[model samples]
Target: MKESSATLRDLRPTQFAVGMIHVRRKMAETRAVCADSRYAFMEQRAIAVVRGPGGVLHVIDHHHWARAWIELGIERAPVQVKMDFRDLDDIDFLAAMMERGWVHPFNERGEKVDIGTLPPSIAQMPDDPYQSLAAFLRIARVFENPGEFNAKFAWADYLREHVSGDSGTIEGFAEMLATAFRFAHTPEARALPGYRPEAAR
Candidate 1:
């Protein structure tokens, strides 16, 4: 239950981008918050990690925050070890992680790729435009909070279908988001993550 300080370089991102825009915005916010003498950066801990084989600390969540910290030149941060899979065989460990929804094998293209294809560091994670769209949708309350494992991934996949490109400029993103917001309310989005029928809401 105790938190341990870890070098940001040593933590492995479990999934791909949560949205680079989200990471950049968080980096700015984190810097502002940490600038206040009354606020301690260490108090904002990255969530649980699993000590995988060969002593690699695999981050299960807070990927956006972690990426932001790295981009902000943060070398160390507090992390909690939720489980240690180092003792298990590699196959069993990976299986366990998948079973617990701790790993996402999808790439930025929204295609299910090999889990081995995952980036060894947060810096290498790709930018998925759908991730940005999903973040915007969440903020706009286009759908209720999914509360499901990898819910963002679900939203990302949904947004991917409506979006023509996998990447975009700031202006392009604004336009895409506006379109995504509209799409989220339609019957087409009913099967998406956290979709709530108008009557249900």
Candidate 2:
């Protein structure tokens, strides 16, 4: 079956209800896709990090892609809608982002010295622990690109269990995640996946 990125608004009431039922069934079958592992070293503690000055970070798995509750005077059933990644043109979204100056292209990771430069307490690692965790999570299929995203939070929680200490690692790990997300949300960075600078704007 082909996947589509069509939003819930695109579906009629009957189609939306049926899609929601299917989605709910799928969600109920899996508890956690990215965060669970039998390997003792792969565990991570869940910590809420502030995104903006007052905004809290919310991590939702790619599942639950469509369907949001609509409230009307405290009476509402969640409006269930179906969506598929295939429905979206990744290239178009990337192009739009670049024009808005939300990303920078061709910047190598090595050039970003500020990325891994957290304070000591927040930067503790088990000798390239991020790499190890990335490998583990990759095998478990936690993230699409292990190298693209840092696994410091998982590593820190694992360290805390074995090392028996509070190194304040979570804060620094959160910052690292924040940085990655910032880059992704940027205009140039977003273009990497779908836009060709020489061909189009």
Question: Among these predicted structures, which one has the highest TM-score?
Answer: 1
Pairs of residues clashing in candidate 1: none
Error of 1 at 120 (Å): 1.1
The TM-score of candidate 1 is 0.88
Tens-place lDDT per residue, model 1, 1-201, is 667878888889889656888787778778777356412564465556889988889999788778888898878877888898888888998999999989988888888888888988987898887887787666666665554465678888987877664255777777787778777777778877676576225
lDDT by residue (tens digit), candidate 2, 1-201 = 222122222222101011232233334433234324411211121111112111211111121222211101111112212222233354653354345432222111112233123212111211232222223333333333334333323332333233322213656544543443333334543333322233322
Q: Per-prediction TM-score, please?
A: 0.88, 0.19
- For model 2, name the residue pairs that clash: 4-87, 5-87, 102-186, 102-187, 103-186, 103-187, 103-188, 103-189, 104-188, 104-189
Candidate 1 residue 177 C-alpha distance from true site, Å: 0.6
What is candidate 1's CA lDDT for residue 92?
A: 93
